[model samples]
Target: MATATYPPPPPFYRLYKDYNENPKSIPEHPPPIEGTYMCFSGNYTTDDVLPSLEEQGVRQLYPKEPNVDFKKELGSLNRELQLHILELADVLVERPSQYARRVEDISLVFKNLHHLLNSLRPHQARATLIHVLELQTQRRKQAVDDIKSGEKSCRNFSWSLSEP
Candidate 1:
């Protein structure tokens, strides 16, 4: 059977392109906290500057940012994963009739998942794995249902042709 290939999904490609074009900037200062607060001097309108203060406090109190770059790095990795999956989906759609190709695509997905989970901390990895598995299960079930429906329709058509 011939294998087919498709381009990345629209959203995935868009996100990938955006990431490629505009990589996130790691802030030199910490991100700002939302709300007003009081300082020893008096009532201080601490808007965004407090992130540095908060960061200093954290640094002084703790050994380090225990989850260093947790937000930014995970977010970037997630984008990469999304792009990979979208590419895989495109390939699978193109090669629907090729069992070997489908297998290869699925294996690639598992490998990606494995690598992603391994890259995360244990707690975070567990949470991410659960969500990813749920999504995969739902999509796979829908695909299976669609294939079954198509097969049934084909069978019905063949029967009708033989009868007439």
Candidate 2:
């Protein structure tokens, strides 16, 4: 009998790579505002929110079926949106010549979309923003520590060079 070789699991880094490489491959749903709404005084997951909209003849923008892991899925969606914004920013920053005007226009559109996504769920949006800020602060502190350690090593190296 011959042993079979299995392919390795896809890396987490490349989970979004396909979509990033060809965004158009993923069908674009209309913006969330196109959906119908039902006012609820209580908390609701994306699943809870979908039926009401569907009943009102509003198409659900999300490709996933209901009862999926809303929290994780929503996080992934938000992450994708943020990545899109960052990619646009990078393009804008890199092209200071002919693309400047185009960059400005796309950047403004990105900002509006980003703002709309964030505004959809106020509490969740605030929490996500806070989490991001905390992570950024931690990264900055680590960077500062690394620089200080490097400086100290350099200082010691110079002192040793000066001695004897």
What are the per-residue Cα lDDT tens digits for candidate 1 across 1-164?
86559755665344445555567732245576556666786766645232332343321211134455545645654665576567667766786565565555445544444443454556676889999999999999999999999999999999999994
lDDT of 2 at 23: 75
For residue 7, what is the lDDT in candidate 2? 68
Give the per-residue lDDT of model 2 (tens digit) for 1-164: 97559866667645456796787665556666433455686543444332333454443334435354545545755675676567667766786455565555545444444434543675687889999999999999999999999999999999999999
**Local distance difference test scores for all models:** 0.59, 0.61
Model 1 regions lying over 4 Å from their true place? 1-59, 62-121
lDDT of 1 at 20: 54
Which residue pairs collide in model 1, if any? none
Residue 36 lDDT in model 2? Answer: 46
Candidate 2 Cα misplacement greater than 4 A, ranges: 1-120
- Candidate 2 weakest ten by summed lDDT: 44-53
**Model 2 accuracy (lDDT, Cα):** 0.61
